[model samples]
Target: MKILIIANSKIVFGRELKEELFQKDKNIDISLLDFASLTLFDNTNQENQTYSKEFLKYKNIPKISMFFRMLYIKKVIQEYNFDIVNIHVSRWFYLLILPTLIKQKLIITFYGSDFYRTSNLIKDIQKVIYKKADAITFTNPLTMKSFLNYYNNFKDKSYVCRFGLKTLDYIDKNRDKSKTEIKQSLGYNSKKIIITCGYNSTKAQQHTKIIESIKKLDDSLLKKIQFIFPMTYGDNLNRENIKNILKSSNLDYIVLEDFLYKDENAYIKLASDIMINILETDSFSGTMQEFLYANNVVITGSWLPYELFDKEGIKYYKIDDTKELKKTITKIVNNMKEYKRDLLVNQDIIYRLSSWKNCIESWVNVY
Candidate 1:
């Protein structure tokens, strides 16, 4: 089958998924077209630094290139003669709305943000696409529930295609190193590390709650723990906020300002004692899956629906009781061995549920 995968950009997960699919099934011809590359920046007069900011705002709002790109994508679809046109990002409604015009089988994959908090108009457009597509895949149950609630008729077409990881199978290979050795290498003391990572200050990730929780901890308890914030992008904003928070708090922490993207698994899992994901809403988090794979105790916010936690192997903290976050962290730190064993058993269950093999099998059967 010839599949055309369209996405907004060539981010880590996007690139990894494309490579995995092609490597597993060479018989399947897969082509990737990123709208980010197609949308050029108007850098005729602006400084280099200002160009990207201007371009991002223009691209995000979709006012600058929707019509022209929709026409271009339609032409590309016809020219390529693809059997299946799979869209990864929801914003591609500029093209998917005209699926009837393209004369090809359509598949739509819903990542987290688009379904959780979008305008009614965008949601309506998404509903039309959902109704028209041959199949719709959601990375997590929360997104699937959102869709099912919005469009009752889509019950037959929707399927849960949970997020997966390649590294899970071999995660145990790197567990030989002692936690103390890993901490020393990373320039952190042997204190318990509580790591939370996301984009700088997105309200959806709800990182401020994690920071506030740490700040509220008693100084006696706080002295034994350290925080690490490994932001993916927007260094300046994140750095300033982190700096201000650190200055105000008695807690020890580090903000890795270089913005590490590659080796995220090694840095986050190996260097830290525990991983925290406090998102207001999440369809599925690749980071959460990674932490589970590495057998690290993961504490996430409790706002997620029951469907998202159907096959869980991690602990959850209520969003309202963030003050209890520090106490939970203390318990994990005090009984690290017991928690580690629980995490190992949990990883086994998670591996069975979210292994790439299982995910690929489901994908093949979806059509």
Candidate 2:
């Protein structure tokens, strides 16, 4: 069977999935197309390497460029005649409604924002796309239900699957190091425990409000905790706003706007004592799972749909508002020993649910 996976290589999960597929079956004929660079990677060849098919980078209006890009994609699908054409992100599905794309089995996977953040017009477009899709995969049941609410006819085609955590190998490698040891090795203060605030620089992360809550903390309490905001990949304006907010406050914080290597990111999560993932919405957060695997106490927004966590018995706290974040943090700080013991129970569950070794077969079965 021939499969074509169209995804941005920058997304860690996309790269991990590509690697997992090759590892699962040596003879599997799969090609990974990085939409950003227009490069394709194939494992069927003797060299098993990537070859570039550079297209002219259009500097024109987005719509005009997008039209050409869609045409190129249509050409690729016709030329390759893949048995399955998997578009890893839902936002790009509008282009797949073209006649050539649906000839083979078409699969569209929905990440969180792509489903939640759509406008009404896009929803109408998605109605058509949903009908054309041979299969639709969602990260969690909550997201699937939300989609089914609007388009119930496609219920049979919809499936709930997760893009499992990719950082487990790195977490295993640092098993010998204590949290304090890991922090010190990474040049962090061993005395102060970490309270990570959100995962990215997106406005949905609500970094400003999180800092507002942090500002309300007692200076003495703030001194014992270091706040970390992973801003490596998102809006620059939002990153600047977060940096400015953090700079004006007396609380100790780090804004990691620069990209970090995989091992570095794993150790940071491992060193964290608490994670505040109060994003506006999410569908089975991989970051939250990674923190759970690293044994960090997680506090999430009640607005976000994470019922899967409860069903799986993954321990976590949820707040109705950002103001509640401070109180929760204070509670976790005072009762660190109890929370640590409770939160540690989540590691096994997270690993079992999220490791690619366990989850990839589901994706293969989908194909």
Candidate 3:
């Protein structure tokens, strides 16, 4: 079978999933297309194909660029004669509005925000796109339920297809290293490393709110723990503001604004004693799952759709709002041993759910 997986290059999972698919079944030919760069990548020659300069000259214009991109993608799919064309992130459905663009079995995968936060015009466009889709997949059940609430007619075609952990292999390699050893290697002292605030530099992360809450804690209590904010990506302007907040907050903190290498990220996760993810909305967060795999006590927002973790018997804390974040942190700090032990007990369950080796079959079945 021949397959084509298309997604934004910025989303790393597109490439990871492509590699895993080929590893699972060597006979099945697979190719990945970066929608933004209009680059096509394949395993055999590891070749990359991009649009001609003549066509790319008009790329600055939105409508013209999208038109040519759609035309180019249609031509490529026809030339390759791929049996299945899977488009990740349903928001890109605007690019596939024309039914004739894809003749083979077409799958549309929703990545949370795409389905939950669309304008009426995009909704109309997706409504048309959904009619042409052969199947639809969501990363979590909550997102699926949200989709079903609107488009009940596609109930049979919609399936929950979560991606496997990209960090599972790295976690295995670093599992033997004790948290203390990893912390020392990373230049951190004996202080408990609490990965505070949230995952990124987005306004949704509510970094200021978290900082404010931490400021309310007593200085003596604060001295016992070290806070690390993973502001590696997202709004650059907001990142600077968060740095200022951390500077003035008087808390012992590290603001990570630089891009983290794979090894660096793995070591950071291993060293962390707690992870706080209070993002406004999330599907299935890869970072949150990674911390759980590393046995870090994770605290998330009650508003986020993380029912799968509860169903899998994973132990993690949740707060209703930023107000509860301070209280939760205080409790975890006071009872560090208990929180760590609870998370450690569910290590095997997280590993089983996150391992791509276990997850690849479900994706295959979806195909």
lDDT of 2: 0.80
Better of 1 and 2 by lDDT: 2
* Residues 1-367, model 3: lDDT tens digits: 9899988654556777898899889999999887876778886627575553435676679777877777777877888888999988776534554555447888998888677667767776677677778889988889989888877778888898878876767877888877787787766665565564577788878888888888898777888888888887778899999898777778888887666555667887888888888877788888888888888888888988888888888899988988887788888888889888777666688778767877878789989
Cα-based lDDT for every prediction: 0.64, 0.80, 0.79
Quote the lDDT for 302 in model 1.
Answer: 67
Q: Candidate 1: global Cα-lDDT?
A: 0.64
Clashing pairs in 3: none
Please report the candidate that would top TM-score against the real structure: 2
Total clashing pairs for each candidate: 0, 0, 0
Off by over 4 Å in 2: 44-56
lDDT of 3 at 25: 90
Per-residue alpha-carbon lDDT of model 2 for 141-199, expressed as tens digits?
Answer: 88999988977679889998778677987888886787788888767788897988888
- TM-score, per-candidate, Cα-based: 0.80, 0.91, 0.87
TM-score for candidate 1: 0.80
Off by over 4 Å in 1: 8-12, 39-62, 65-79, 92-101, 184-187, 190-194, 197-201, 233-249, 257-264, 306-320
lDDT of 3 at 356: 83
Model 3 whole-model lDDT (C-alpha atoms)? 0.79
